[model samples]
Target: MTITSKGRLTLSVAAFATIAAGACAEPSEELIAAARAEGMLTTIALPHSWCGYGEVIQAFKDKYGIEVNELNPNAGSADELEAVKANRGNTGPQAPDVLDVGLSFGPTAKEQGLLQPYKVSTWDSIPADAKDDEGYWYGDYYGVLGFAVNNDIFPDAPQSFAELKDGQFANSVALQGDPRTGNSVMMAVYAAGIAEGGEPGADALNKGIAFFKELKESGNYVPVNGSAQNIAQGTTPIYFDWDYNLLAMRDKLDGNPPVSVVVPTDAVIAGVYVQAISAHAPHPNAAKLWMEYLYSDEGQLGWLKGYCHPIRFNDMAERGVIPQELLDNLPPAENYARAIFPTLPEQSEAKDAVAANWGSEMGVQ
Candidate 1:
C-alpha cells in the first residue's frame, strides 16, 4: 500500500465504502431519521476482491429506497482510520458519518476516540467477541487465516509451520508482512499459537517468531506485500494470506496450474472486517442504516456469494449459502471459533514486541 504526506491511501472504491469515509453531521436521531425517510445514503468502506461490495451496496439502496452517494470508496484501513479521525467529532465538514476498519486497528481507533457506537437490529447474530463491548465497532464479513501454497511449487504443501520452515519449501515461501500492519499475517501468528496451544492463553507467538525467523534464514522469505499474482506464478510457492484471496487467486489461476489453499491442520484465526460510524461523518443516518443492512440475513448471504465467511455460521448453513468449494476447504465451524480480535492491550504488547523483538527476530524494521 502507498501513502502520501497527507497520509491518505487509496483502496478500491468498494473498500472505501466498506470501511472508508463519506460525510459527517451532528449526532441526532431526528436528523438521521429524517435522512433515512428522505431515501438518501452516503457512505465509505473497504472493497473486497470477490466483488462483494456491490451486492450490499445495491441492497442498501433497494432496502431503503434511497439514492446512495458514497465517496472515497477506495482506501485502505489506515486511510479510512485517518480520514475518520480527521473528520469525525467536528461541527461540520471535518467529520465523517461512519468508519469501517480492520479488526486489529478497530481497538486502536476506538481507544484514540475515533468511533461511536450503534447496536444494529441483527446484533444478536454477531458474536460478542466480534463487536465492541461499548458498541464502538462491529465485525462484518470475516476471513480465516491460513497458509496458501502454490501446490505446483510444493508437491506436499506443509500443514504445519514446522514443516513449512524445515522442508524443500524454504526458498519458495512468503509471509504476508508485519502483524500490526497486516491483519492476515497477525492472524497467522495467532493461529500458529492456537495450533501450538490456544489463543489468549497459548505460547505460539514465540514459536511463530522462531518459525518465521528460520523461514527468513531458509531464503524462502518473500517479504513483499502479498501478491496473489506472484503467488500464482510460484514466486511465492508457500504464502500466508486470507482465505478469500487464496480462494480467488486459486480459481483465477486454476487453468494455469493447480493451486492449493488449506486451513492449516493445527488451527485457524478469523479476522473480522469491521464497521463503525465515523466520529465525524457526513451521513450518520446512512452509516447507521448501512450497519443495519450489513447485519441482516440478506446482506449476510451476500457475504457467502462473495466468498467471504459471514459472521453468522448457522445462518449461512441454514440458508445453504456456504459454497461447496469453501466448505471443502474449511476445517470446521469449531475451527473458526479460534478467531481472536486485537485489543488495546494486545496492540500495546505487539508494538512492544515488534519494537523490542521483531527487527532482530524477523529482520524487518
Candidate 2:
C-alpha cells in the first residue's frame, strides 16, 4: 500500500540495452496476426488528455494498423464496469475490448467476473504490489493529486487546498468529476481531508466532505465538473485532478490562458490506475495486443511524456532507457517522495464514504 518514487535510476548503456531488449521484446508473430485479423480494439473511458493516451492510441494504430474504437472518453471507473456488464452478449463496437480503470475498480471487476487474465511480456518488471498475481488486472501509471489553475483568472494561483477556500477563489474551484463515481474526484476529496489533518481512511473522507461543504458554503466550490476546455476558458480556473492530467492540460492549452500545476505541500495522495481485458471482449486477440503495447517500453515512455509515472518507471529508469529530457520535465522528484499511497481497503472505505455523503454533506448537485 506504500508506494515511493525511486527518484532517478541509472545504468551503463551496454547493460541497459541488454536488459531492455529482453524486457521489451516484441510480441509474437502469432499474436500479431491474430490481432490484425480482428482488425479493431474497443476501449472505454479513455480520454486523450489522460495519461498521454492520445499519442499512445495513435502510436498503437500506426504500429499495428488496428483500428481503435474508443467509447465514451469521459466515463468514470464505475461506468466502465457497468459497460462490461451491459454488453456481455453484444459483440459490437459498444462492448469494450479493454479497460483502464482505477486500481480499486480492478478487484471489484474481477470479483464480478468481468475481467480476463493475460500478463504482458514485461510482466516481471512490474512491481508485484501493483499487479494482480493472476494477471486479471495490472497497474499502468500513477500520479499525485494536484491543482490546475488558469493564470488569466488568478495571477497568483492558490497553492493548497486551504487556499482554495478564500474569497478570491469563490466561484473558481471545481473537482474533476462527481465524487460519487469518479475515482479522481474521490481521491481529490481524500487529499483535501489529509490537508485538513484527517487520516487516510473513513475519517479523512468524512473530513473531506466537510471541507467541501465549507468551500461550497463560502461560494468557492463550483458545481460543474472540471475539464481541459473549462480550465482554459477560466470557467473552472482552479481544478483538482491528477498531476499528469493538469500538466497535459497545460501543454495542450499552449499558454493561450497560461496554466500552473501545483502539487500541494499540505498533502500528496498518489493514485494508480490499472488495465485489463474484458472477460467477454469482442476482439479478444486485439485486446491482448493492446495490453502488450501498453506495457511495452514504448508505451511506458509515452505515459512519461504526459507526466504520469508509469508503473514500470523504476524498472525502466534502472535500465537507463528513460530519456534525460523526460526526467527533467517532470515535477520535482521530492514532490512524489512525500506522496501517500492509500491501501486498497482504505481507498474502498473512503470511496464508500464519499459516494454516500458527497451530495448530502456538500449539497452539490
Candidate 3:
C-alpha cells in the first residue's frame, strides 16, 4: 500500500459519522448501559507503554466504569493467538475478549474461526485494504521501521542499514523482539532485505535472513530482546524498532539520552497492527464498546499522542479535529505518505516463510 502525501491522507470525519449513523446503531446509550452492566473486559498482550495503550486503557475505564483485566503484557503475537484458542469455551477472567495482533495474524485467526465479525462505527474512514470485508479485524494504527539511537551512547548514529553493518556498531545493535514470533523484528528484517536488493513481497525475506546472519557472524547482533528500559539502562543503545515506539521512548526518557529516530531512506517498510474481537468473548457488549472507543476521533488522537499513525488520521485531519500541536511533532506527512505496506496476502505468505526459516537461517532460536 502506497499512501501519497496530499490527496489520500485527508479524509473527513463527517464521512465517518455519516457511515456510523447509517450502518451501525450510533452506539446508543443502551449499548453503554449494557456494557457497564457486564462490568468487565479481558484483554491479552497489550503493553501500556506501547502506542498510547497506557492512556487509552485508563480513559476507557474512567469513561465506562468497567474493569479491564490485561493478561500477559509482554506476550508475542503468536502467544495472543494461542491464548484465544486455549481459553475457548471458558468464560472466565483469563479468556480474552479482544486481540490486537500483527496484521498477518488477523486473517489466520479469522480463518481458524477465532475472531468474530464486528465493524466499528468509523469503519468507512479506514482504507479498504486495511480492513477485512466482513469486519473480522481492522487495521488500527501503523508505524515505519526506523532506528532509535541513544544519542549519548553513539553521538554519530548510523543513519542507514548499511552503516549499521559497517563494523562500527559491533555487539551493539538489537532488534525489538525475536523475528520468529514478533512482527516488529520480522518487518525489520524485511526492510533490511529491501536494502540488500531483495524483492518487494514476502518472498524477499530470505535475503533479510541472510543479512541478519551476516550481522550475527560479525558479532554485531545483540541477541537479547530490545526495550525502552534496556535503552535507558544502557544495555541496548542502538535499537531497531518502530518509529512510534522509539519516539514514545524519547518522551518517556525526556532527554536522559536524547533519542534520535531516523526513517532509513535506503529501505522502508510500514507495518500495521489489526484489532479483532474474540470469537467467544465473555463480555461481547463490552468488547464491542471498546472497539467503538478505539476508532473514535478521541481514540485516534490518543494513538497520535504516542506517535502512532492512526488508520483514520487522514479523515481526522480533513475535519480539522486533529490538534495542530500534535501535527507539529509528527514527521512530515510526506515521509509516511510515500511508505510501502505489504498486502494481507503478502503478509500471510511472509509470516509462513518466517515461521519455517527464521530460526535455522538466522540462528535466532
Candidate 2 lDDT over 84-115, as tens digits, reads 99999899889999999998999999999999
Each prediction's total of clashing residue pairs, residues at least 3 apart in sequence or on different chains, is: 39, 0, 2
Which candidate has the highest TM-score of all? 2
| Clashes, model 1 | 39
Q: Which ten residues in a row have the lowest lDDT in candidate 3?
A: 4-13
Q: How many backbone clashes does candidate 3 have?
A: 2
Off by over 4 Å in 1: 1-45, 61-79, 88-97, 193-203, 315-348
Give the top-scoring candidate (lDDT): 2
Query: What TM-score, over all chains together, does every model reach?
Result: 0.74, 0.94, 0.92
List ranges where model 3 is wrong by over 4 Å. 1-26
Model 3 accuracy (lDDT, Cα) = 0.82
TM-score of 3: 0.92
Tens digits of per-residue lDDT for model 3 on 322-355? 5556666777666686688877777776777778
In model 2, the Cα lDDT at residue 63 comes to 89
A best-first ranking of the candidates according to their lDDT comes to 2, 3, 1
lDDT of 2 at 214: 91
Against the true structure, candidate 2 has what lDDT? 0.88
